[model samples]
Target: MRILRFRAFTRPGDPTSGNPAGVVLDAESLSDADMLGIAADLGFSETAFLSAIEPDAARVRYFTPRAEIAFCGHATIASGVALAREGAGSTVAFTTNAGVVPVAVSPERATLTAVETSVEPLGGVLLAELLDALRLETTDLDPMLPPAFIRGGNPHPLVPVAAGVLGRLDHDADAVLRLQDRKGWDGTIPVVHRISADRFASRNPFPRGGIREDPATGSAAAGLGAYLRQHGLVTMPAEVTVEQGAETGRPSSILVSIPPEGRIRVTGSAETL
Candidate 1:
């Protein structure tokens, strides 16, 4: 029952700045209740439980303090790095509840290929509800990248805000939880601001996970890459850098690469904690 802790999505030379996640290398004998308890006890936003490990593939489950989720980007990165440190090789396929996610691990970083991504326009009513819940107005949104629903592994309502407005994002936890319940969003609601053509800043509110905000969110970064590609916001085969968690003092850097067509790739460095 040993738990390995790692900080995923960190910058070079700074191991302490990233999202922390707990990983259970062997969870075959653990039940759902046990996993939930461990996740809650760990107090990380999400944790990874690995079982049925093969040479290059393993079955993995993600759990937050509140409940189980289909997928988690930071925890997956942490798990990949943990396995790599344990001599699992450079590449591994993780079979999650969402889908099969392939990870390439290195001593410095890990890159994960997300599941098939999809984007859809957000309905007016739903958008209005979300805005009301988050205490935002239409003027606060960036017109170039309109609000939409994006899915890489999990679903997120992508809210693109104007520069400087992202720092002012505030919402009641209960209000956001109610919106998540109605919208079936299992992931965070990412409020992003474009810093440049290939750089962005984001703040993710994850009330459904029993967290007010997440410092680094790899899954939401994947979803953002899909949104940019689908809406023609960025050219094909583009590389984007996302800066998140500064508000939380974690200051994580997430690198996302969008190919012409296929799953998006999220890359970041991880360090054992």
Candidate 2:
């Protein structure tokens, strides 16, 4: 029943930033209730439970304080580093509820190739509802990156905000929860602003997970990469950096690599806490 904690997506030499996640190395005997209780007690946004299925493969499950999630990027990164530290080798395959994710671990960082990604335009009615919940106006949106439902592992509504509007993102918890329930969304709603061709700032609200916001969201970043590629916003085989958690004072940087065609790669460093 040992629980390990790690801060994922942290910058070099600084462990104070990034998102904290819990990892249970041997979770084969733990029931769903036990995992849920552990996640709730840990109070991290997400925790990963791993059961080794082979020397370099394992079945991983993710849980938040409120419910189980199909996939979690930060927790996966943390688990990868943790497993590597435990002599699991440099590469490990994690079979999550979403799909099989392969991670390449190093002493300094870990890179995870996410499952297949897809993006589709969001309906105007749903977009309006989402804007109302986030206390944002249509004018605040970036005309270039329209609202879309992006899925890397889990699905989230990507709302691209205009410059200077990202810092002012505020959402009603109750309203967001209601929308999430109605829409059957398990992930956060990300409001992003482009800083440059390859850089962006983002804030993700996770009312469905009983969290106000996520400091660094790797899954959302992967989805964003797919969206950018699908919309011809970025050139093929490009790398994008997403800066997040500034509003919460736990600034984190998530790097995503988009290939010409295939799974997106999300890379970050993690430190044990």
Candidate 3:
């Protein structure tokens, strides 16, 4: 089966810094094992396979190098761009494992609307474990933002830390993986600093998905939006910008829109890599 490659959530006009994902447009004949093998072979953080496609919608699946994920934001964005390139349409609904994700694409950018979202308080034990794994003390946390678990398409613990602390975090990979498995979390998203009410810098250690750090995490961003709104941190109907991947040298910009009704919208630019 032929596979297409694209970089999603990239810096405008610079494909070198975005998260690389595989896109398989003609995936109808492939089985679950086949898709997993393809994703593993591609060795990207995640790959998107579209087994069914139509003018207005498509059935899609997402896989990481290690396992199948419920949904992937960057891969979904890449799929939207790929569909547009293949003449699918300007807008399309992707029937995904999480739910129906709607995406809109222009020539230069793509935006995806996440499914229903929510935030839950993290238990003290798990929060302590996570903080210890990252060598962070409770005092290191951002007083205003605190820590909580956010769920957009997947679950992640969003820990808010003081400025300059995010770039300094280093955790044992195996321990992080064990914690993720124990808690069933996709990743631990450490939001390093809040630049402003509308801007923030975040980092994620994704040992469970077999990555040390993700350049741009749309899933986490969506969840972060929900977390912010849930805590009454941001005003209603807000547009927030996230800066990621700078530590990895492939900086990414993710635009998140939180509506008054609570659904989060994530938008980014993509390019073929």
lDDT per model, in order? Answer: 0.90, 0.90, 0.84
lDDT ranking from best candidate downward: 2, 1, 3
Q: Please provide, for model 2 over 1-273, each residue's C-alpha lDDT reduced to its tens digit, 9 standing for 90 to 100.
A: 568999899987765788999999889999999999999999999999998645588899999999999999999889888888877777889999999999998755789999999999996788999999999999999988889999988899999999889877779989999999888899888899999999999999998887899989989999999999999999888999999987877789999999999999999999888
- How many residue pairs in model 1 have overlapping backbones? 0
Task: For candidate 1, write residues 148-175 as lDDT tens digits.
Answer: 8988789999999997898788877899
Estimate the TM-score for candidate 1: 0.97
Give, for candidate 3, the lowest lDDT window spanning 10 residues: 184-193
**With candidate 3 superimposed using the best TM-score fit, by how many Å does residue 264's alpha carbon deviate from the native?**
1.1
Q: If scored against the real structure, what TM-score would every candidate get? A: 0.97, 0.98, 0.96
Per-residue lDDT tens digits of candidate 3, residues 139-209?
88988877888887888888888877887887777887888888787644555579898999988788777
Off by over 4 Å in 1: none
**lDDT accuracy of residue 190 in candidate 1:** 92
Q: Local error of candidate 2 at 57, Å?
A: 0.9
